[model samples]
Target chain A: MSDPMAFLLWVKGPMFNWALAIFALGTLARLLEIFLLGRRPNYAEPRGGEWGPGLRTVLTRSVADPGTFQRAPFDVLVGWIWHVGFLIALLLFIPHIELIQALIGLGWPGLPNPVVDAATAVTLVALVATLIHRLRHPVKRHLSTAEDYLIWTVTFLPLITGYLAYHRLIGPYPLALGLHILAAEIFLIVLPFTKLTHIFTAFIARWYNGAIFGRKGVQS
Target chain B: MSEPSIERGLQALRAEIDAPVAAFFSSCVHCGLCAQACPFYLETGDPKYTPVLKLEPLRRVWEREFTLWGRIKAGLGLSPKVTDALLAEWEELLYDSCTMCGRCSLVCPVGNDLQYMIRKAREGMVASGHAPEGLIGAAVRAVQTGSPMGLQWKTLEVQIRHVESSTGLTVPVDVPDVEYLVLLSSMEIINFPEYLEAIARIFDHAGVGWTLSTDCFEATNAGVQIGSKDIAATLVQRIVDAAVKLRVKNVISPECGHAYTAVRWEGPNLIGRPYPFHVYHIIEVLDALRAAGRLRTEGKETDRLSLHDPCNLARKSGVIQEQRNLMDLVAENFVDLEEHGRYQWCCGAGGGVSSNERADALRRAAFKRKKAQIEAVEPERMVTMCATCRTQLEEGLEEFNMDIPVVGLTEMLAEHLVEK
Candidate 1:
């Protein structure tokens, strides 16, 4: 019970439950708070249908428009790289797939180990570049509060720790694995409380934006 | 000062926060892409002009009242409160700089509607008596004298008489059961009486049944520009009453961008009911006439012409292609600015920036983006649908010592109309 393996077991058992509970309940409470606030009915006659544009923006906003790309190429390109890389490593890695299946009874084929490893490396690099850009760019630097830097650290830890655990470079296998799990647990706990809520709320925000402009017959 | 208070400002901000605003505030990741989209930020190189940061007070109110973490922080006196001093500092950001062009909303990576929140933020600013003096004067005059610039009915009567004498067409007033009730802005009545002549000539050429209502001819909504729903509703109600009294099937908003937005987009919502008749921008009416084969033309302008899309018309209300259709009808060599239509750069004087005299230099600075766009095309003459945009473009081009002249789209179309 006093061994490093026991520490790994404890992280996977009791600490994991606490993290999951906070993540689920906190997310639900935040979502409920938004929905309960309620929107007023628009009495203006609509020029177009809402559903089509609302659905379109949810997918289209993933890419920056040409004008936006030209103005801020670094932000747009690096942002895409990080998101794509992180999603691949999170959903396509073999162990993550097994964890998802264990939790939600959903299973899918996993990517090869090398592909996942490369994605992890790319994601780590992008995250660091993102932080440097935040510190350097005048607008980003001015707009960023303490919460932004805190969110970056929390998001960066798990990917780096997972990469180290896979390579067994930091310590023994159980000790590295336990550290990775602990980092992930901290991320999950803070997800609902901070700007990390954008994971789900982005969809809602895009739909509302699309619908409002759509009602005016514009493709926002 | 006695009329507006911090307590009322806080309440107004709390009342303005709804589901979409909640989602927008929650989704923002501070990516700063919105700053790139804003002409003011680009022109001034000021981090304070960033579009998303313009909503700081509103965001603070949203956080302090809505979120659990924010509530906890507030209880501990950790989070900043939305005070009158904070709103006073933000007055220039919200009113003097932003044109409410919605470009920030278009370019946000998280799809945050940053301009929408800024519009809401102005409500609090006004409630706290932190609004610009020029805008406050305009709003007060609009409510008290039925004209933001204090032009009375007799002033419009002089223009009507001049339009009638020149065009040799009867400019009917108070005519009931007409198909369209035409409205005008005081700017057109004072600065550009040619707009009235153009409307009379165009309507007569098409053989359309339209009349001006002496009951209410002014369409510009300074209340809307000042972000006061109560005053906006009062002004809107005057138009509604005029339209109902005339029993017109359609009402036409003049060649003013904010007036079109006020009547066509926010009119019904402000008055709390659907309009009995439809509201159309004059360009929309003109385009409809052309499409129906009613508007015949004789000749086209030979020189190179380019268009400046008004932010409220093209970006805010989707009146993009209609202007182009009208442009094609009258101009043989019409070129477009590099970025026109919904993605066009603002003339930097809409959304009450022009009304706020303190923003004169800032607005001129912001016009550098539009100037650069115009330089790329080198048009002999620039055309626009909104009167406000035309004034700004004219002044900006003159300020830069550019020889190009600005003209109204409707007046340009009227010049080429086929003789009856």
Candidate 2:
């Protein structure tokens, strides 16, 4: 058999160029979304104190409620597992690492092959579990729209294709790799357009909550 | 188990909703983030009781009976059967378990309005004659009589006279040509008369010309909370008629959260035009007084206070900051609870959940989150701007045996009011 690395190089030449173009365009689109669609100041003006104090109060108290996270153990477990798993897969994927290394000249010590493989497998299972939850649960199923299914599909494709490419499970490693890269690029393009945008906004919400409660002298 | 008249009523309401309600139900993308925001979901670990899942029956009906996609799914046998038993079960889940607190909406990524949907579902139940017997009975009495408690006009008169004698401030009733007409909920007159006393003292202190109408003084419209527009309309119409009759410049809705929203947001629309008189929630009135230097308070420097934002006032009516301002003037030791303002936690008492005996367990479960929040502050007292929330929190504290004082924002202000 021909060297898989050779095929990878050939695909990389064109795929890299396509990835860069989409990355630039997608980043630009995300920025436009932040500036245009995301600029509404949903916070109300404090009727008593200035904005500064109110803002301070919101920021401080959100962190103070460490106990809410503690009390709702199942929620915290699910939330953390899903969020952290998604972030690790998204940021440390080989192609994404390559992009980061190329753009910023930074690299982390790679995880052992077995660990990487196991994490990827676990993440895929968790994603499936979450999707099933949305389907089987009557309340969640009721609230779900068609766009929700689209997000799940878009998110799932990259992880699945990337796993297939890593294991060389398909006809050729190169083809799987190219599909994986393409899926990821498409996800980036749609990230801000869908409910996935909650990733960026959740922290802002958390911190705003912390500060508001902090100023009020309540433990977040 | 089946009453023909009630079943007929429910069928008519479900039929009347038409397409828009169905469309909204069909648009839910369940990320479960709303689950995190729901107090019931947090305490019980029961996903079935989560705010998002609570809307399933409506969603199923929309899919199977209303939407084209739903019709296709039903034709294919892909949609589950929605039997009368299923409807009965959902009646318990949707009406009895959920608190329509709107917290879920704030955290919802798509902004799926669970509260609005639940309210519509309750309206449907009321039409079907499936409403909780207590709510329906109270509403019926409210419509036939003037107040939910069935307090007679003479009793209201004595309550008014009592306020005047106790506070050395005359609370005028049925006075024509008053500049402002104040409306009090029967709960305030009977359960928390200090709220009425606070209002009279504040108005007297400010020298604002205000009169309470003995005929239509109760601000609470149980219809609004229970999702009966007809009953809500009847309650609000009385206030509107009195405002117009009294020739008042403004109508002040006391520190009742749902009452304020009903009159301010729905009152004008129900009346079919903008009301001639301005409607102000008591918090707004207090903020105005503090701003204009008319209502002065010696802040409680020693006592630590935390403010619980009521859902109706904060999310529904957009009066989030007004309560905070009132808290600041009234409490020197005020600490803002986390998730304050629009993001604040529900007191687990809104949307008529406080009145449903069957829902008490779910209500108690939901209250755990708010209690945790209160304990986090470790404040000497937790102050609120809504009367129902005050009742709910106080009741919850007693039921749960938590050490926290639940007082109205008006009550707190009255304690700190500058003596003239």
Candidate number with greatest TM-score: 1
Model 2: per-residue lDDT, tens digit, B1-420? Answer: 566344554454455343224323433445566677777777887767777677665666655654444566689998886555666667777766776777665444333456656776766666655677667767887898988878777887787788889998888877888878988877777778788888888888887888877668878878976777778888888998988888998899888888887787666655566677788888888788888999877756468888888877776666777777777776678898866776678888777777777788778788888888887778888888777888888988888787788788887778787798
What is the lDDT of every predicted structure here? 0.92, 0.68
Chain B TM-score of candidate 1 stands at: 0.99
Instruction: DockQ for candidate 1, please give it.
Output: 0.84
True contacts kept of each: 0.80, 0.08
Q: What digit string (tens of lDDT, one per residue) describes model 1 on residues A82-164?
A: 89998998999999999999999999999999999999999999999999999999999999999999999999999999999
User: DockQ values for all predictions?
Assistant: 0.84, 0.09
User: Candidate 2 chain B: worst 10 consecutive residues by lDDT?
Assistant: B18-27
For model 1 the interface RMSD, in Å, equals: 0.8
TM-score of chain A as modeled in candidate 2 = 0.70
Q: Count the backbone clashes (under 3 Å) in each candidate.
A: 0, 35
Worst 10 residues of 1 chain A by lDDT: A1-10
lDDT of 2 by residue, A71-147 (tens): 34444455456556666766666656777788789976555666667777887887787788778865567556777
